[model samples]
Target: MYVFGDSLVDNGNNNFLRSIAKSNYYPYGIDSNRGTATGKFSNGDTFVDYLGAWLGLPAPPPFADPTTTGPRILGGVNYASAAAGILDETGQHYGERYSLSQQVINFETTLSQLRTMMSGPNLSRYLSKAIAVVVLGSNDYINNYLLPGLYPTSFNYNPTQFANLLLNHYARQLVALYSVGLRKFVLAGLGPLGCIPNQRATGQGPPGRCVDYVNQILGPFNQGLLSLVDALNNGSHPGSIFVYGNSYAAMGDILNNPARYGFRVVDRGCCGFGQQITCLPWMPPCFDRTQYVFWDAFHPTQAVDAVLAHRAYAGPPSDCHPINVQQLALINFL
Candidate 1:
């Protein structure tokens, strides 16, 4: 399987980049990787790591690794980067980051290498069976469109129009990926962006509550994504399997039922900073991560991520549409 998108699936890719959106520091990854951070936004494992383990596969290595050669490529790669988004300008404030367009290009290189390493039939079988996970768009909303001064995308389009624009562009990118022979795709929806600690810190709404207006924008986009999935599976792409991971609903469940989900904190992040800040070099992480829903101002803690991924991978119909990832993987598309 291959993982793509932003900090939610980053797994240390940004450590190699000259970007500020990195987690290779203390108090991050203290639970996983033996107390040394590995560049995931979470304090422990990420969505991809949990999903990979559930699928009986090792977590894919970062694509940026110099040693990602030969059979290592067979397990696939993680092209996700901290602060990356579908739109190039989404994370412009963070300097260099892999836009979705760039991630596709990297996958193209991987396809090229696979062709070199295997027979044609084997390559086709490999692509048709492998799963590609995409978790993006939150940064496109939180970091760009709503940044107020850094970008003008929000000004040019209303929420409905913006959702259409993103869906249209995203469709083209997904088709470009399909062109290279990928069959199974996991399209993750954006979570409730307004409720995350960083967005709360933005002061766009009343303190200690979710910013409903910002979160409202995510629904139209997620609906469009679901429609896209249905279209892809309804004979548009023969043998294609696409499943929607409802991250929004998952996050809602966590926030509304934290203690039920075994989490103690739902509103604030585990890492320390001022009311609006998070995980600064001066700030240290809380001692107990299992209690917190978020690890930083923007990302979920690993403990929370595991629950989300488990549900998306094998939860009921509400967590993953059409069929969950477990069912999606079991089918023989060929």
Candidate 2:
């Protein structure tokens, strides 16, 4: 399995980049087993790490990291970069970052090198069997379309128009990966962005209540994304298997009914205070990471990531439409 997207899945790719969207610092991975930060945005593992382990594969190395060079690429290389979005200029505020277009281009280069390193038949088998997993659209909506002054997308187009634009571009990105020989895909929906500590604090929607407007704004994108996945699965590629992961619903379930998922604090973050500025190098985190849904302002705790990953792997119909990740991986697609 290969992974791509923003800080949610970025293991360490942004660490090498000149981008300010880096998480390779103290307290970020305060509980990632070894207790040392590894560029993961959360207090422990990212959702991808848990998903990879559940699939019986060690988490793939970041595509750009020095340690990922040579033969290690075969296990699959993660091209995810923190602050990445569907469009090239989406995260310009961060200075330097990989857009979805660039990540695909990087994947193409990796595939080209793989073809050289392996026999043609072996490479073919590898490419055809691999699952191209992507988690996107959130940064596009939050960083590009919502930042009215910094980005023209939101000002130029309203919510619906902006969603259509994002979906159209997203379709092209998926097709690009299809052309590169990936047959199975896991397209994750953006989670409850407005409910996150960062959004809640910035939007200021009364104490303990989520920012309804922000969450409402993202509804169109999720709905459109579901439809887009269905269209793509309908022979956009002859043997393609595309699974839509309902991230909004998955995270919402936990937020709405925290105890049901073994969580206690769904509103606040476990690390630092539940504010956008919390969880820096100087701040100390809460004692129990398992109780809170969020690790910091933007990312989920390892506990929440584990829950979300398990659901995506073998979840009910509401969380993963058509099928789940494990089911998608089992498909022959030939």
Candidate 3:
């Protein structure tokens, strides 16, 4: 599988860049198998890592990692970067990031490398079996639309218009991937960012309450994304399958019933000071990490990732529309 998107799935692509949104330090991977920070934004593996494990593949090396070449490419590559978004300028303030379009370009580069190792038909066959997991759009809101002082997106487009704009850009980018030979896709919709520690830090409402205003604006994008999935599944791209991973519902389930998921702290992050959101390098994280829903200001703990990965892999249509990742994997092409 080829992974794309922002910090939610970023394994370490930002480590090679000049981006400030990095996690290559202590406490970031305290719970990972390596027990060393690998630039994952959580206390351990992200949902992408769990999904890869279920798929029987090792964690794909970051695409930007110089060591990620040759046989390593066969396991797939993760092009996810911290603070990346659907638009080119979405996270420009962060210094460097591979936006959705840039990630696709990198995939094209990977395809070029694969061609040298196999016949055209064999290459096509190999790509046809690969899954493209795209989890983007969160940064577009967190780093772009919401930051009116830095970006003009909010002033230029209302919530509905901004969503349409993002959808249009997203559709074109997905079509570009389809043209490149990726036959299967898992498009994860945005989760409720309103409840994240960063948004909560803003104190938009009553104490411990989520910023409903932030989540309200996100509805149109998630809804349009579902429609986009339907259109892509029924569109002109033969053999191309698009599945929408309803991250909103999957995450909502955990937040609304934290105890059901074995979580205690559902309102704040395990690391970082109040209102600071992102962890300062080397800061000590929570001792009981498994009981926390969030690992940092914006990302979830490895525990939450496990739940999300499970839902997307085998949950009902309400979690992953049309088919789950397991079913999508079973789909064969003649």
lDDT of 2: 0.85
Model 1 TM-score (2 dp): 0.97
Expressed as tens digits, the lDDT of each residue in 165-273 for candidate 3 is: 9999999999999898899999999999999989988878578988999999999999999998998888578988999999999999999999999999988898987
User: If scored against the real structure, what TM-score would every candidate get?
Assistant: 0.97, 0.96, 0.99
Off by over 4 Å in 2: none
lDDT of each: 0.86, 0.85, 0.92
**Candidate 1: how large is its RMSD?**
1.2
Sorted by lDDT (best first), the order is 3, 1, 2
Candidate 1, run of 10 with poorest lDDT? 273-282
The runs of at least 3 residues in candidate 1 whose Cα sits more than 4 Å from the true structure, single-residue gaps closed, are: none
Model 3 poorest ten-residue lDDT run:
273-282
lDDT of 3 at 88: 92
lDDT of candidate 2 at residue 266, scale 0 to 100: 71
Give the Å shift of residue 98 in candidate 2.
Answer: 0.9
Give the Å error, residue 90, model 1.
Answer: 1.3
True lDDT of residue 160, candidate 2: 84
